[model samples]
Target: MKWTRAVHHLTDLVEKVSEMPGTHFRFEVVELWVFGDLLGAPRDLEHIDVALVVDLPVDEVPWLTEPLGAEHWANASRVSRNPVMPFWRSAQAPVWNHRIERPALAWSKADGIAEETLVAVGDGTGELVRLPAPEPDELRKRLDDELALSLAALRHDNQVYTDRRWSPGKLTPYADALWRTTTGYLDLLDALAR
Candidate 1:
């Protein structure tokens, strides 16, 4: 689907999930990517995925998917360790592997709400209404703190996995990617500050 429609669809879906009876889940759109068309991505890639950072038990996450009424895929929550190969990060990764990285579409949180911008234009005029994006310094400090926590978690996981002679698990790569992205964001913020 087109990017704008995808945003609307995802927003609607998330809202529905939140409003479910007896549901006490809090989620934020940490990342989103709307590709192709007027967007910069190649035309062949036409889809959107919103990465939500949610506070809920992993077992309960499927409840969020059931409302979608589709056979969606999900990975078991664990510390999974795999090869840090660039091949896992390409356009074809989703075909060969299980995951591919993409940019975020909506990323704003205020008063504990996931805020997104919806644009509607048919005539000669348009309107833009969105929660103000977080300030760079705030983002930088947040990322910095997150990176430190991730590193600590990685250290603990490494020790436990080593004791059992077990291979790295999901948390391994999760922490690694967290470190990498957090650093990248910090660098970008630094550049922007200058």
Candidate 2:
């Protein structure tokens, strides 16, 4: 599935959650990514992993870490209770602070609210670690650095995939996806620079 579809799914979930009576959860999407759920099955990858920041009353915070995994649905692998977290606990990344305009996704009941996503990865780290958000100038520098790294990795992967020396077989699609992600980051950098 295209990443857009996954994003739509997230939007729907957010809308639904927001409407539940007495639920004071506020959600902000922070990141979108695609990868094999397991390292051994790269070719069987499906669905986009979304990172979000949710704000709720402190008394209701205990339910956040419940062992409820994800609920498998038609196109989505699992749709678990969206993680409940503090605003600062959202994915830490160098995001360009521009408002996103998705009318359908943005809640209309409230005024002056724009939906956004935070990006993060869970790389086998058993515990959650907090990474503080950097200053605006520092954030720009970090974003620039990350953009350069992504571009360099993309170039190296492109060369490897086309070298004709190594046969990647099924992994070709994976490399293609990586290239797309790299280009996406470049696009983001361009937008931020403007």
Candidate 3:
């Protein structure tokens, strides 16, 4: 449920991908975070996500533009962040609403990974081990344990959040989304590795 285990798992994912052949370059487990509400998630997802970047030959950037998701990478060209909103950033910040803000968890051009140090870790081992999928019941228990921390955040302003904010039914969509992506992604990565 802690960030460390999620980070370790990400490192494992990166290592697994790197072990595969024909990577444009390499995969880095560069960042992880749990966003929105993770109270009692099926997994202690740091809302966990990772970046896969290749050390494209400086000359080969052209080849990658179409293949490696150039649209998201375009955010890097402006490289800016705003302070008033720690979570909000933009090329020309300190301005208005609907600023074409960059995502807080986006990949950097240099690191090609998320830059949060909250849970970043790696080891220089020669080989890595595969981790079993996390136990869902156990993960939800941990998340439920952590929910006490969010009460303060939700109590601000005239509006107050309560237990009803999270019905078990509300989680089905999130779980389905996670399942669709993680399983599909793992399948794609496995095929690519093969």
Candidate 4:
């Protein structure tokens, strides 16, 4: 599917879910974020990755004995049986493997909601109308932060690669590749800052 269409579908789905009666349970979608290849605006994409930060009211789940235990159990059970579990799993898969090193675009629920937030609303004709993108300064700051993080990871990985006694030579290639990536980010940041 196209990136735009996928985004539209996601927005519609979220809206529908949000409109569902809160009688069964109460929850809030605090934030929605899109990351990975979808941000590149490719012509076609296999899937769009999104992270939804939700707040489920534990007070509603009275069956549990303790509040703290209820919070934990509710979170676990929510993920296990969420209607969009597949998408949720995909969105979180990168976190477990430390692959979400890149920055994400935060999809805001409405204008003036938050900084660096993107909003897309339906036009009532099956098309989506996106709000303005973040300001240049915001974009630059995000890139700068990401570059700093990448550099830190590179330094830490370098230490591990050099200290290991066995197969240290094997790590050299991976280290070099990471160095190249770090430099690429630096170059991109420099260009953006210019």
Candidate 5:
């Protein structure tokens, strides 16, 4: 399963969640990233990162988390990629960002999102520690940079309009098959202010 299919999977969940009891707001997929951390070279062996935003009640946050976690873990080993973080949460407004990306995973891994599977065997950074909050704009910028290069290369080679960020250009080839095999991941963030 490629990123697109994974996205559809996410949307399926979202639709289900929205129909539940009370206060269900609109949501959007804001980010999608893939990278290979365990792989020494930036060639292969990576993870998929996904993020979505919705305006949901804070009290119900855990409702989404628990179910999503169950689904993610059930499919993690299949992802084959790194720590696939298919995140989704409530936000105030839309995040006008890049469509999809292959390199965003690089930044996400560096930021310690997928360190568990990102590193090679016996490389898990077990135990958690306190850290500063994240800066979405910066990560988004990095994604934009890689996305630009990936798009250019794709257009140059395919000589056609891809329209689909993940598909058009093979920006990240591994993305071509994520739903087939994976572990776990949550790249989504909620911007309450936005």
Candidate 6:
């Protein structure tokens, strides 16, 4: 997917989250962080990873009173009542990974938030770590760096495939796919440079 398209999809998600009624989930998205492969702006992304810091009111889900385990503190620098789980599941209690029809976006229905997207619920206590918003220029530079690294890895693998005397039938398709991805990265870089 093109970087522009991915950005649009992310924007749609944020809009949807912002518009979600507190009554529905008994929580509000206080902070959002987009990371992983989506940050690289690759041509064909596997998925988008978003980390949401949410205010899950104490009155709601009163069972989540204490930290879950030691690992939670090690990773996030804060104790979590539950391990980072799919926000949708928490949103739709008793229905795990539920998909419901809502408004449509460029790539998915309004309810089709990526399954990989996770939420860290904060229960009134100020223990949950809140990260500062990422700067756009820094994120763009990081994307450029990641794209370059990906291109290098692809090129190296293509070279290895050639060295192994892979047949044209096999090599041609792989090379073509790589070329398309390389072109996509270049196109994104050009757009970002503008």
Q: Largest TM-score belongs to which candidate?
A: 1
Clashing pairs in 6: 1-43
TM-scores for every predicted model: 0.38, 0.33, 0.22, 0.35, 0.23, 0.29
Provide the lDDT at 52 for model 1: 41
Off by over 4 Å in 2: 1-49, 52-76, 79-135, 164-175
Per-residue error at 23 for model 1, in Å?
A: 5.9
Cα lDDT listed for each candidate: 0.32, 0.35, 0.29, 0.41, 0.31, 0.38
lDDT of 1 by residue, 4-111 (tens): 444445455445434343232223222222221212322222333333433333221221121111112111111011111111111111111012222223322332
Residue-wise C-alpha lDDT for candidate 3, range 114-183, written one tens digit per residue: 4242232322111121122335564344333222212222232113223323655465434433343344
Per model, how many backbone clashes are there? 11, 8, 3, 0, 22, 1
What does candidate 2 score on TM?
0.33
Off by over 4 Å in 5: 1-41, 63-83, 92-194
Pitting candidate 3 against candidate 6, the one with the higher lDDT is 6
Better of 1 and 3 by TM-score: 1
Off by over 4 Å in 6: 57-194
Among these predicted structures, which one has the highest lDDT?
4
| Model 1 deviation from the true structure expressed as Cα RMSD, one decimal place | 11.7
For residue 53, model 2's alpha carbon misses the true position, in angstroms, by 11
| Regions more than 4 Å wrong, model 1 | 19-45, 49-53, 56-127, 166-194
Worst 10 residues of 3 by lDDT: 78-87
